[model samples]
Target: MMDNKTLEKKAIAAECFVEVPFFDLDPMNIVWHGNYVKYFEQARCELLRKIDYDYPQMKESGYYWPIIDMRLKYIKPANFGEKLLCIATFKECENRLKINYLIQSAESGEKLCKGYTVQVAVTTSDFEMQLVSPDILKQRLTDYISGLS
Candidate 1:
């Protein structure tokens, strides 16, 4: 685990606004539970872009990051057209990329959903899982975190 100060300095988060569309809702007029995964992806992509390590960059570095595990907890159902604010926070990236997400009402700020995803790096050519993160990832994260000092 990282110390408080290190966590604070290294922390990176991004927020994205989404309006529930009719197509995303189920017969009950509530957003489908599985749709939250897309929300998480949106926010996570934004966070990754902030550090210039988005998917394209990752692939360019010769690694394919595949999600190894994920979890989602729903607190409330969202209605169609309801505005939501999704926040994705970077948690850990030493050996793998771990990101936490929260979905809340844009108007009321009520928490509606929360979840996390863990991704492990694999070589693009051979698809061999990497026990340790690639140097490019480590260096970029280090630079970003150090910049917060």
Candidate 2:
């Protein structure tokens, strides 16, 4: 069985920090639930960029990865001015791209929210859903994983 270290080396992950601003809060002073989606996007973009598979690159490869599904669970509420550490982990990318996200308090290490997003590849010109991922994505991920080891 693969150990944690081996698994970590195979996975692509990136983290970004966000400070809850007053604009993101509702009247109750807690972050609005919908704002978590933006946080997830920020982390996911960083992770994809690390692998050189970000949106622009995907387009250049003649593929469009549109988010087909997404889910989020709130563990705790973030207050205004609270700092959050958002981590995005690439989970799977055989037929589709799946990314998991975790948001935690930067100071307390308490989990604020967690979620995932799944994207399926589609042809840019015809917009037809791809049954299999493009070779470019596989190659990019392969290169990124190899670097970790």
Candidate 3:
């Protein structure tokens, strides 16, 4: 069951559909653990794209938002050829970008995995880590939230 906090994320999230390819399967025919990061990245990119703050735009704005931390919990094995619905929700963007992710079986709505990633902004030239999220990111997030209403 979803709580209010989680229900809130449904109002502010980006989604994508992915058909699991055979290449993504491990020897056991289940998706390998490491490949989940790539899946998260795809959804993350979609979230950034929705806000018009993807890597290219970030570079143009003179900052690089790199994943500084990540956590994942596997709930079930996803089989090859399964259609998956991936949701990426921008949960926070004050000190860092804290995005939550969910991968569910598109056919049955079973939650297969869940995770979150934290991205920290850094200067493109100096590589100086930012103490707070850059203005561009915060502004974009604000705009996105405003549009949701």
> Best lDDT goes to which candidate?
2
TM-score of 1: 0.92
How many residue pairs clash in all the candidates, one count each?
A: 0, 0, 0
Query: Which digits, one per residue and each the tens of the lDDT, describe model 3 over residues 1-149?
Result: 22335435545688888899999999999999888888888988898898889999999999998888999999998999999999998777767888899999999999999999998999999999999777788677667666777
Better of 2 and 3 by TM-score: 2
lDDT of 2 at 58: 94
Against the hidden true structure, what lDDT does model 1 obtain? 0.88
Error of 1 at 27 (Å): 0.8
lDDT of 3 at 137: 82
RMSD values for the candidates in order, in angstroms, are 2.3, 3.2, 4.3
The CA lDDT of each predicted structure is: 0.88, 0.89, 0.86
Candidate 2 wrongly placed segments (more than 4 Å): 1-9
The superposed Cα distance between candidate 2 and the true structure at residue 1, in angstroms, equals 20
Per-residue alpha-carbon lDDT of candidate 2 for residues 1-149, written as tens digits (9 for 90 to 100) = 22234435576689999999999999899999999999999999999999898999999999999999999999999999999999999777767888899999999999999999999999999999998777788788778767776
lDDT for each residue of candidate 1 in 22-54, tens digit (9 for 90 to 100): 999988999999999999999999998877899
lDDT of 1 at 18: 98
For every model shown, what is its TM-score relative to the native structure?
0.92, 0.92, 0.90
Error of 1 at 4 (Å): 10
